[model samples]
Target: MMTVNEVSRLTGVSIRALHYYDQIGLLPATGHTDSGYRLYDDTALEHLQQILLFRELEFSLKDIQRILSNSAFDREKALKQQIELLKLKRQHIEDLIALAEKTQTTGGTIMDFTAFDTQKIKDYAAQAKQQWGATPEYKEFEQKTALKTEKEVSAMGGQLMEIIAAFGKMQSMDPAAPAVQAQVKKLQDFISEHYYTCSKTILGQLGQLYTAGGAFTQNINAAGGPGTAEFASKAIEVYCRTAK
Candidate 1:
């Protein structure tokens, strides 16, 4: 058990915020001491983590409370999802920084494709392949695709999209439902078959990416309407927790 001050110090959340959270039924203290001092247990700490993550993602306190109070709230899965989303956001920022450097060298026109020279692109590809070839996922992908043609790869891609559409259809279902879990498993396997071994960590990262903007999010939203990506991400959360 940790005192309120301890939790505040550990999480960098202000004492006032903690009191407000408890006041609002958001992050209630798990227990109390002999002098009636608030104390937090592991579960309370976990809830606080979720609350912080949602706040970082700009979710309103009301929504975070609702989500955390939900019967199906899964702490481990939620933590993984938050970490993945933050990492993706960080990566996007890094990419923007790289592009900014390129822009500086080209007088900020930002329209010059010449910066991406053919040899540079090829070299990058070679370097990526060399680095990733050592990973189990990449080795499996390389071995599986060694004899596959471009046509077959494209066909597999279409099938994966079909499964994504199916996910949209079942967006309203509880993510822990067997039906939803099956689709998540299919998604994992399909990725492993076509691209790389879809480890749970990577799969969770992709779940976050489903709404990471660009055509991917647009297409997913078009498939099942807005919030479909969130449904898929939650489904992935369930899958990671319960998968064998």
Candidate 2:
């Protein structure tokens, strides 16, 4: 495990930015040391690499989180898209450089502004974003959240965590118990009501994400204590299996 500072130095990301990412449920540390220092494992580092790639493409943090959090996200496919976008960006820059040189040679009197056009890059990016976020659930989430204030969204997140935390308190009980299954149903209902329609398949995917050792796991553990995320994941698994 590497310290947060070490990660910051390695990735050239600011310590403050990393902390903010943690706060916003982006790139959470894989675990914490006994002394309360944040620690990241190789998996977390790989996630960070993906985030940085999206950042390089000028994606907003919110968009990056949404894209990465999707259970269907494909890292290799995303990498290919990022490479294509970067090549376009590089070509744009080269065009601008050539324009600048030509203008300089012509005594800076050229009035042509065609080189300033960036419609191609912008259109490609828009198309890529649409492709990545085209799921019905994602569309519903976007529509629902488009009207909410940031504070309201944060409150909703807190409420969801509270439900997960409840699972932590029931860790001693059988995960397949009726009570645990009810809680899983409640979680699914909450997601369907507020964010998107949470089908059994989606719920199962979320269960995996809850214990996938990233911000979701860290935040759930922070709220409910250690091992809570795993317990909830188990409960979810049981719920999905029985409900089907």
Candidate 3:
């Protein structure tokens, strides 16, 4: 058994933090000494180690508690997830450094908009492997998509413009109407097919981009007029909820 102070000294975590953890029921006292001092057994020590590891990974205490209390918690899985997350963070920092160096040499001519692209090609490869195995399915899909000519890309863009035009025509209609919702689904499906994988997080972010300004918003608005993008965002949100 170890005293709270001993655990604090050993783990380099503050004693007050240990007390707060106990108060929150995240790290309850294992037992009480004869004089009523809190004591932690080996199991509690192990729990502390896990908690500290999660803290190092920048997980909120609540998130860590939920993870630690889950019956399916696996040390190996947790370590693997942490390692991936840390590697991503390191890569993000490196990208930022590279972008800064580019800015220094380009005399502000070359933009660092590439940094805003949070999605990495390696992540797509990993997802492909996990979903379709180590086969050539992903490669085939990539080849087919790449074979698309300028005309094909323009045709897809035309389809999006048509959707935007319809949205503009329905500007005065109820935002919850089935017609608008249908357009939203069509847009999402189009994105999933032509763009990267369309997760809810990514979709929501892209929807925001339509009205968030910058070249993307400018292009969308120029096609269908102002408020086109905002309406699309609302309609897309509704579609996402129903589709899910």
Candidate 2: segments with Cα more than 4 A from true spot: 149-162, 165-169, 208-230, 241-244
Q: By the lDDT metric, which is better: model 2 or model 3?
A: 2
lDDT per residue as tens, model 1, 12-54: 9999988776644456566678997788877678668777887
Clashing pairs in 1: none
Q: lDDT score, residue 202, model 3?
A: 60
Per-model TM values vs. the true structure:
0.45, 0.83, 0.41
Ranking the candidates on lDDT from highest down gives 2, 1, 3
**What tens digits encode model 2's per-residue C-alpha lDDT throughout 1-244?**
8999999999999999888776655676677899988888887888899999899989877678777876667788889989999999999899889989998888766787878888988898888789878888889988999988765665676677778879999999999998999999999999999899999999999999988865557767866788999999999999988896
Q: Between prediction 1 and prediction 2, which has the larger TM-score?
A: 2
Error of 2 at 82 (Å): 0.5
C-alpha RMSD (angstroms) for model 2 = 3.1
The CA lDDT of each predicted structure is 0.68, 0.84, 0.63
Best by lDDT: 2
Clashing pairs in 3: none
